[model samples]
Target: MKLVTLAIICVLMLNSCKNKSQEEPQNQVKVEKIEYASFGKEIVASDAIAAKSMASHYKTMKTGDSIDSKMVAKVNNVCQAKGCWMRLDLDDGNEVMVKFKDYGFFVPKDITGKEVIINGKAFVKEVSVDEQRHYAEDAGKSAEEIAKIIEPKRTYSFEADGVLVVQ
Candidate 1:
C-alpha cells in the first residue's frame, strides 16, 4: 500500500510540471469605451500603443523591419463590402494597404476621409496580380477595374491588430 502511494505521488509531481513551449503570451483584448464614438467599432485593445508614424518616416525605413508603428493617417479607401481592409494616404499620391492581423478584426466601412490611428507592423511587399484583383473585388470595384490589374505592385503594407478612428 505504501509503494502504491509513493508511485502515485511521483506521478502527480511529474504531471504538475509545465512545458516551456506552452508559456507563450496571449493577445488579451481589453475593451475601451469612447465618449464620442466615430462611425467605426469601439477600440478593442491598446496593445503596444504608439503615436502615429509619419509618411516620410515610412519612406525612410528599410523594408522587412519589424515595425510596431502607430500611425495617424487619412483614410483613402476601404473595403466597401466589408471593412476588412483600408488604404491610408502616405503622401505624394502614395498609400499603404492596412489589413487586420490574423483576420482578427475589421474597421468601419464608411470611414473614408476620416482620420484613424492604427497600431501594427508595417512592411513593404510585392503584391501579386491575383491578390490585387481579390482586394479590388473586396473593395467592390467593377470587373473591368479588377481586370486592369495585370502586374504585381510594390507597396507598403500594415497588419493592424487595433484601430481607432479620430474624432
Candidate 2:
C-alpha cells in the first residue's frame, strides 16, 4: 500500500511539473529597460533633459502646479489595452502619468522600460476613484483590485503633444 501511494504521488508531481513548463512559451521574450527601444517601434533620437531634473523642478510645489516643458524619461509602464497612456519613471520610485494630447498618438504597448522625450504640459492632479478604477481596468488589473480604489490619489501627470522615442 505504501509503495502504491508513493508511486502515485511521484506521478502527480511529475504531471504538475510538466503542465507548468508547457504553460510557458519556449520563445518567451525577456523585457529590459533601455536608452533605446528593443521591443517596440523604432524612432530617431532627440534630446531633452534627464527625468531627474524634471522632478526636481517641482520639489517645492503642491498639486495643481503646472509646468510646460519637454523632458526625457524611462517608460515604466504602458496601457495594456490600447497604449493610450504611459507611466514615466522618476527618481525615488516616483512615476508621472502621461497621456497623449488630443488623443493624437498612442505609445507602443510593449515600450516598457524604453527612453522617450515628451513635449508636454506637466502637472499634479488628484485622480478620482472613478478615474483610478478606469485606469486599473485599462491596465488589465483584476476586478477585485480595481474595487479597492476608494480614495483619491494625487500624482504627477502630463499631456504630451509630441513624443520622440529613442531608437
Judged by whole-model lDDT over C-alpha atoms, candidate 2 comes out at 0.82
lDDT of 2 at 154: 88
Residue 71 C-alpha lDDT in model 1: 71
User: All predictions: root-mean-square deviation over Cα?
Assistant: 16.6, 15.6
> Cα deviation of 18 in candidate 2 (Å)?
68
Model 1 lDDT per residue over 95-119, tens place: 8899988887777787899877777
By summed lDDT, the worst window of 10 consecutive residues in model 2 runs over: 36-45
Clashing pairs in 1: 52-70, 52-71
Candidate no. 1 TM-score: 0.66
lDDT of 2 by residue, 1-167 (tens): 99999999999999999998998886699887555432222333455677898888756557988988788898988999888999898765789899987886787888888788888788988999999899989988998999999999988898887777776
- Once fitted onto the true fold, the runs of candidate 1 whose alpha carbons sit more than 4 angstroms away are 1-53, 61-63
The TM-score of predicted model 2 comes to: 0.70
